[model samples]
Target: MITLLLMMGTVSLSVAQVSESTLIRCASTEQDSLRISKNPALFKLRQQSEAVIQQYISRSRVNKRTNADEIVTIPVVVHVIHSEEGRSMGGAGNANITDAQVNSQIEVLNEDYSNTSGYKGFYTDSLGVDTGIRFKLVTIVRTYNSKSQFSPITDGDDLAEISPAWSTNRYLNIWVCRLNDRYLGTSQFPVVTEINNRTQGLATSEDEEQDALTDGVIIDFRYFGRNAEAITSRIYNLGRTTTHEVGHWLGLIHIWGDRNCGTDHCEDTPPAYTKNETTDIECTPVFSDCRGVNTRNMIENYMDYSPDACMSVFTNDQMERMHAVLELSPRRAKLVEFSKITTDELLVDIYPNPVQETLFSSIFTPNFEVFTVSVFNQRGQKVIQDKLNRTSLNVKNLPSGLYFYKVETASKTLTRKFYVR
Candidate 1:
């Protein structure tokens, strides 16, 4: 018994996984010497991406406002590029990614971005900033192939030549696939990439266009994603990997950047950095890298390197920067159109307001993905899926109630609500 208990107690972890309380204590202990270190690579790239994004912003007609005229709701399209090993067609698992996983991820973003998770320790007790960005998973699908051809057209269209790629101006296109050996996630002077990797497990936009890095995020599928139907395999399963990466995509930098010190250099965030260079988060509180100024590192900021649970705040300044990007960046303009594509903002409809069973609707897409429809609840849970071979659905036995229908194609999502009484 003693041996077993001791062994269990000895479970070890890296510095990244330190607890919030311990992170705070470590900051308290290293009150001095946590000087800022120059991570030239990170700094250079950050400047570059910012510059390119600015150029486009300057030229955009929407650059008139420094902040949003209103809280902008962006639609998201997740292209689940899986191995043939485990997809709807593959033997490995459902490979067809369930509506659960998709919905869970979206909910995570909404909660984190809204700053409503009840974790505000990183920022001063008095400071709080709300990033008015809300992402909704269109009850639609935008699946496409690398060629960007139409996908399950009965749903969307085959995403052929995703060139001019899905316009970033309206919709945020997130391609979740098996990483191509050639390119990890991509981000150019302004583009972003998010992918699952082996070594880093998960990583976000590293591009610093100015310094030659692309902007994006990556996650090891082993983390929040699974080849099987959706289920949270572990704590970090739906924790905040994408939230962290999306922060980068929105132009928020790592609070500590390449060094540690009093000021994270972002003026908006407190100064703090970890020199520990480790990634363990399962152990007791671990003291962090040296602390230069009395400033506490925003370890909880989604942008910080802390483990997903430890990081959780976005300051007003961060919001300003993101808002700046949205108003100025070319990709943001497409959001409205994306909303149209994914949510049927175009008003495409399915008859039978309350579907007792048979519900039929035409899914129209200017382009991308050949699709299939999946029914989901308000919680964004998938209730049913009708393959694309048929445009209409026979929802004969589903209990009558309100349900939202999603038409998924390789390139877009088209959704509308109906009744099933």
Candidate 2:
């Protein structure tokens, strides 16, 4: 079962939009800086998370076993919040995206992250590695709002105003809607802290609940998925907006590091004087920075602000840094574990027809080694699956539909039907 909050009283404010020629306007670092300033305690947490990553990197250099080659699968849930007019209009209009468009974006993510795309031939010698990260679509949510566009004083506030997210520790929640501004996308970085006695080191719950309302990505519907209609801009139509934002989500800073000759914490990516040349889809010319060092910048790196067609690689150091975040960050680690958990457990009850917020299930026993619960749609397709160690499952994010659930224990499997209204 899920909790729904209705927001009252909205203030509309005007802001600058992105230029028509710009490829992507990622506001992740800007949003993160604001959050750290407002909550000073997060400064220390950020320091701690960085320290862990540095230590992990140092150890990996000395010991080969420090980092494993296991692929990380991240569950995704897209929240499509559209105006009634947009919903009625449908197709590729603003705030009105089709399911195929969403799936195309996911396909792009898998290809780019795995380096399996047809454009892999463009990878330069500087290309170092594949991030070994993959995404799975867990569900899709559609919401209706009268507001044509949403602008958050903070991205967190905007998420709360539109749709509440699923468990951030378990799933990546993406909010796709019409933006009053010109930004293509924004994302939240991983943070380390403790929450409710749980090791939510990567992302704390209180901050995620209040300051960061939802911990994931927010994309403009026009640039969300790859399709002729949704591809409002020729340069950004390849579904790389979500790809770039997810890089930030997984701790990959811009290749230029958002500063002149700044460090992106990766050794392989050459230092750039600035990210000014990223607006174009062509290869950048060789240039020297303040250090008088001249070299051709890796304009093709995904972390750069380059157009989707010009981006292709994640250097070895970048992959190592992201893998470290996955292994050392507690919340991220737990999420991976929860995703891999599977078993058979006896279920006693799944109650309350026309489920309002959360759905509750009573287990016959709690001593099973591994118990799993999953939900399926009327078509018998598995829509939601997670370790059911607790008595409740959040269904608030589920659209109004008929669904069935199966509980698996060591000795028995139980199935039930429920509806969300």
Candidate 3:
């Protein structure tokens, strides 16, 4: 059983297998309520942050200093938690997502946030602005545990102790696992407030330290990456679940604002009369009005509850809001600044591509003692699998064709495509 303390009231949900047609809860509002309940003072802090963000947005509009040209790269760490049984099953089933699946999600993030996604041309009427934000994988932390399901209500405390968040000031931590209550994902927003009259401005270092421990995104493994084998839902198979959760991590709220005709604080987004229903499968247009002004809902917004196929854009105003949070929030500012650390260290190179015989591999980092290599054919069949105590791999007897290789280390997983002629 999963229970959530929503912003308005308490709600209990009986756990069940989430069908593809069932609605997926973004869970940001429930998460926000829980955080504020833990520290009631956060309520005031969030309000202050919102006010400041609006001011920043206004200033940018007038001065034409939107900072849209300045690209902000966020370093990400994906923590994949799975049980022994799930790991043995493998092949993107449930908790056992492949390394290529993880990287595929990252590629989707880069494309979506940069406005270069393949679906961009589909939403021509209201093509959203590029937020100038890009995500790069810094590390992957894989854990094998006995637990099958982690509680989203508990903020994933069960596995967090084992795979604790890496310095939030530098990396955007994402925990991927099986979630109870059929939730797709959840995220922690940036909320900063002045402590006392003595402090000059912004939140105190003590506040940031406390928030850093829970500062990240949590996703259900089944809905995480863009592999068909991992994601069985045709509506959500494109890996947009993480895209939506990351939007919350960057301080975005639901398009409906968790209320009837409430504002998401973005001027460009049309007022939504209510939350988009999960069964509204065909990207059906919705019309509504706020204060007597007629408007059409932007069900395509990433922050909405619309299906993945229906989601496509983030408005110009939404991009400015995220940029403001990145600039004004101290912890968020530190994230962008500290991400300059060398991410190239995580790169793994596989040599002798299109080879007829032996294939050699080398990792740039010395932290890993051993590596696990798996080769999958174009048909998604694992043809070669081995545990490596050294860097070289022998693929002499494999059938000739295009193949994908996944290299797994203690702290990271790297995937690349190769050809065996």
Candidate 4:
């Protein structure tokens, strides 16, 4: 029998290690960093890997990835592993970072990724360019208690996943947790890396784990920083941290281009990396520390190594590169595939919800797999016939109009409509 390997299906977190029944309870605790130390194995491994990666970068010369579109929408799971304090708000001078902070971060991400207020002279042409990237803070807290069942604390993005390590096509997966060993956050290397979760080298893919544990991004409660765990009223706001990490998640190389600027493939971003600085510095605009000429320095971009407040703008070239990345990367294209959607049988799906030309679906569930989905125009003409996983017909040839779709995956199949603008 041919079987489907799904990431984010079921993952049993070692919750017992921290001696907490709920993740929310755990995140609320005000543990000192001195008290908590990094796991020897993870620390050593990260160190060694980073060093080797640097060497590899020096040996090879490739353009750095600094574009936003290259990184598709990565589904994020924010684990608000609270401590005993339970949404502990240490108010006043040390008032805890409230749920307001969490919501604010989500808002910020939306505004930032959507490039709403962001297109102000940040790019080279100085004209506002919209970055077609979306960041959704998942409302579901996909956690596994001792019982091996999904815990109920999911409070971020609620877009339920079939598993972890999504197709890398339609959606990017992110897990926000405080469970790592003294680290703020970490992510898997995109495609063709020793860290390939599918091979179980560094991280495990969702398909390999057979649960919902492997698909999304994980941010720690303690360092998810301003978002969920401002419990101590202490906001260790590192704007570039999330921006930087997400850049990596989206497959953008550092603006400084790792060892030198020539390796990462970004001609515009120069090599001006400071090993580890606590504060943001004034960098050269179009500065070419490594490569010469017309360099934008690009340090101020979200993908660069600048501070959060300092980072702004995504170049048009970056947008094109990101699209190119989408075309070439398999995991990226999987976002639109049926393999990522959940099969509760009740979840509704609309093909061409934002239909450019045509739409398709192969929705199969426990209740119904061979159901019919009808398409209707504003005039309500049944214009199309579609069978899930049956054919790849041409819908693009159709005229632009308000179209409705009716699909049946299981017990009760229904219809939904969208316009083909």
Best by TM-score: 2
- What does the lDDT read for residue 227 in candidate 1? 28
C-alpha lDDT (0 to 100) for residue 335 of candidate 3: 67
Question: What is the per-residue lDDT of model 3 for residues 321-417, given as tens digits with 9 covering 90 to 100?
Answer: 8998887776577566554445534555566566666665434433323457788998889887765433344677888889988877687777899
Off by over 4 Å in 3: 1-17, 120-125, 194-210, 340-421
What TM-score does structure 3 among the candidates reach? Answer: 0.73
lDDT of 1 by residue, 1-421 (tens): 0111112122222222433333211111111111112234544544565666555445543555545346778766565544333225322222235566666677778888887766545363455566888887654343433221111101111111221123233345454432211111222223322211210111222221111111123332223332233322333444466676676556655565545543333466665555322244541233345443454445567665455556567776677667665544434433433444544323245654565545544334543334577888777788885554233456767776777887766656678887777
What is the TM-score of each predicted model, taking all chains together? 0.50, 0.74, 0.73, 0.48
Q: Which candidate is the best by lDDT?
A: 3
Worst 10 residues of 2 by lDDT: 7-16
Cα lDDT computed for each candidate against the true fold:
0.45, 0.69, 0.71, 0.41
Instruction: Choose 1 or 2, whichever is better by TM-score.
Output: 2
Candidate 3: what lDDT? 0.71
lDDT preference between candidates 1 and 2, better one = 2
Q: Which whole-number lDDT from 0 to 100 does residue 50 have in model 4? A: 46
Prediction 4 TM-score vs. true: 0.48
Q: Lowest summed-lDDT stretch of 10 residues in model 4?
A: 26-35
Query: In model 1, where do residues sit more than 4 Å from their true spots?
Result: 1-69, 89-95, 120-125, 139-165, 178-219, 225-235, 259-265, 275-292, 333-421
Clashes of each: 91, 19, 0, 81
Q: Single out the weakest 10-residue window by summed lDDT for candidate 1.
A: 148-157
Q: Pairing residues by index, what is the TM-score of model 2? A: 0.74
